[model samples]
Target: MPITLADKLVVAISSRALFDFEEENRLFERSDAATYLQLQRERLEVPAQRGIAFSLVQKLLAFNTPQMQRVEVVILSRNDPVSGLRVFHSAEAAGIALQRGVFTQGRPPFGYLRPLGAHLFLSANADDVTEALGLGYPAAHVYTDSVQASLAHPNELRIAFDGDAVLFSDEAERIYQAEGLEAFQRHETDRHGQPLPDGPFKPLLAALHRLQQIADAVPGMRIRTALVTARSAPAHKRAIQTLMSWDIAVDEAMFLGGLSKGPFLKEFEPDFFFDDQTGHVHNAAQHVPAGHVRSGFASAMVETTATIRKHQDQG
Candidate 1:
């Protein structure tokens, strides 16, 4: 029989996203790969600090039991094999049971997501995330400097997602951006009964939904999700209608209109939040762990590609 990740909720993460490698990353930025590799080798025995996504990964991994394994986390990193030893060591020190990994030695690692059947791809590399998103995977650029997740929801995996772009197609967002608020609202109002097109994160949300159903039989295990968006009233109706059409239900929904999302996300205290807009993601990161979805109407793929090329040159 062949081994497969088909039945599990697989999450592929980068070493930097899963651990606090910012200091080493800074060294990489200032020096050469050899210098960085030496530093990692020197610190091989020390466990890296927990990163912004650490808590989320910890809770998600807890869904697995000796009798049933519901989740699989794979390290999909740009670090060389030597540096990867530290990533695995850190996971063990943190009590996170990660058994699979792919080390690409500074190359973009998104290509492996297809074979992993990853429901989510979280990384510190914007170029890799952008490439994964381009390939139709749910990928996010982890805000490394973002505040860590709250400890309040120890037994629950709480995730929040923006409506447009993150959860649904950027179709209406493009309209909103090009035509302005009044026109966007009117268009949504007229099409309130129609379901919006699926977005990149939809598959991840669906996978989470299935995981939630499976968690029902496990005591003290829970998964809560939210729809946090800037749309309100007329525009909000279509968002809800779309979720209904897809048969997915979120535990909470915040239609913030045009207000800043930071304070509201602080109150929600999600393990993580995803938004396509850099501004929204930056704001949310001030309060909760947040990632920038590099796909949608506001995608900065060109900028990300340039960044990737620059890094490759540095590597």
Candidate 2:
């Protein structure tokens, strides 16, 4: 496909759209965590925000200007009427497209209802991004609970992501998280070199694969993706297997076992880097446009409505 503004897109979103995690059992009435998570799985809605992720995206938007030119944003939710409206209006104010619609939870996104062009598309709704990626559109997922940071202008818009959690399966990671790493490792090791079980990010990976094919056809144009994760050695075995099984191609792979990602990404010079962890995002943003992927099963750090009210009051 032609590298349109739609293709060269950069999105920054709030965490709720990216991941589904419970806010603390605080001001609100509490419910069973498992039941709550189960209910969340069935519904396609934005969860609460992670402060760190939100703050980072806001900082990114601050850097958006005429010099940057073509960039668009979609609030991605009907919830949070006020903030959503603010974001929608801001995009209009800046002459960028702001699409508002109900989207799937975690499937890869396809084309959207907008005129074709080169632009950055961002949203707070994590799940909606899967829709964008399914449609072969590039997007960013963010959270509400995030820290402030600079959104650098990219001369070369390189983007990176983790394969399994960020791109492929939640099954293995979920197993690791609940069942213990050893069990997860053993399960994966037994199934090592086996095909992936069609994780949520699969469609997105296919979309990226399509982009790569297009780039290949046209010279002087490039869209590259890197898989960077903590999975190494025996664990890394599964990731490679999954990629091969899916017939997807990743330009780079760095299996850093519990190491900081910032330094290496600094050298690679990606336009954006996305991961499921706050640590990687925290470090990556210092060097490039950074976003956090919101998974459907993560817990959310809920802030009181009063706190949000206070910020609105200040604003």
Candidate 3:
């Protein structure tokens, strides 16, 4: 018989996303690889600080018990093998049970997602994030410098997401981009009863919901989700309706009406937050462990065009 990942909720994350390496990353960026490798070797014994998705990885792994292996998290990193040594050491110091890893040594690691049966991939590299999304995998570019979530919610995993383009399709965003805000509002107001289409991170949300249900039965852990979007008033209705259509429920919903999401997110203190737009992602990153979902009408529409052209040529 052979071992298989068929039944696990697997997550593939990068060293940068899992542990703080911003200072080291800057060295890699400014100087050469040799210098970075030497530095990593020198400080191999020093465990790195917990990164953006640390709490997330920690909570999800808690679902695994001796009798039931409910989750699997693998280190899929672009860091060289030497730096990877520190990543493992840091995880061990943090008391996380990480058993597998792939050190790409500066190459893109997205290609391994399929082989790993990864339900989600989190990295700090935008290019890797984009590539993963194009392949239709759920991935996010973690904001490694973001403020970590509060210690208050120790037994609970708090996640927040943007509405359109992250959880729901970017249909309304496309409209807003083409027309003005008024037209976008009017459009949603008219069709508030209609559910928005599915977006990239919806499946992840559903998975978390299911995990919450399982945890609910056990009583020791919980998963809390929130919809923190720029849409407000009438436009907010469609986002809510979409979740209803999908039979999804979020613990909190904030329709900020084009305001800065940073302050609100600081108050919410999610373990992790996902948004599509760069501005929103960076803003919330300052206040919470945030990741850019990198999917929407613009990116997805181009992907659709390429697919359509290929199909036509094949036909």
Using TM-score as the measure, which candidate wins?
1
lDDT of 2 at 108: 31
- TM-scores, each model vs. reference: 0.95, 0.53, 0.90
Q: How would you encode candidate 2's per-residue C-alpha lDDT over 1-315 as one tens digit per residue?
A: 654455333443332433223252221136554544454444333324323333323323333444542233333342334334433444444433445433333333334424543133455555565455444444556533433332343222355786555676566777776788788778778888776565445554565566556443443445567888877677888888888877787889998876888887876666556675556776876765576654423312222444688899999
* Model 3, residue 26: C-alpha shift (Å): 1.9
Candidate 1 per-residue lDDT, tens place, 1-315, comes to 899989999999999999999999999999999999999999998999999999889989989999889999999999999999999999999899999999999888999999999999999998899899999999999999899999988989999999899899999988987899999999999999999999999999999999898897678989999999999997999999999999999999999998999999998889999999888999999999999998876775446666799999999
- Specify the poorest-scoring 10-residue window by lDDT in model 2: 19-28
Give the range of the ten consecutive residues with the poorest summed lDDT in model 3. Answer: 297-306
Winner on lDDT (2 vs 3) = 3
Candidate 1 wrongly placed segments (more than 4 Å)? 300-315
Error of 1 at 301 (Å): 9.4
* Every model: Cα RMSD to truth: 3.3, 12.3, 5.9
Residue pairs whose backbone atoms clash in candidate 3:
none
Alpha carbon deviation, residue 7, candidate 3 (Å): 2.1
* Candidate 3 residue 83 C-alpha distance from true site, Å: 2.5
Residue 49, candidate 1: alpha-carbon lDDT: 96
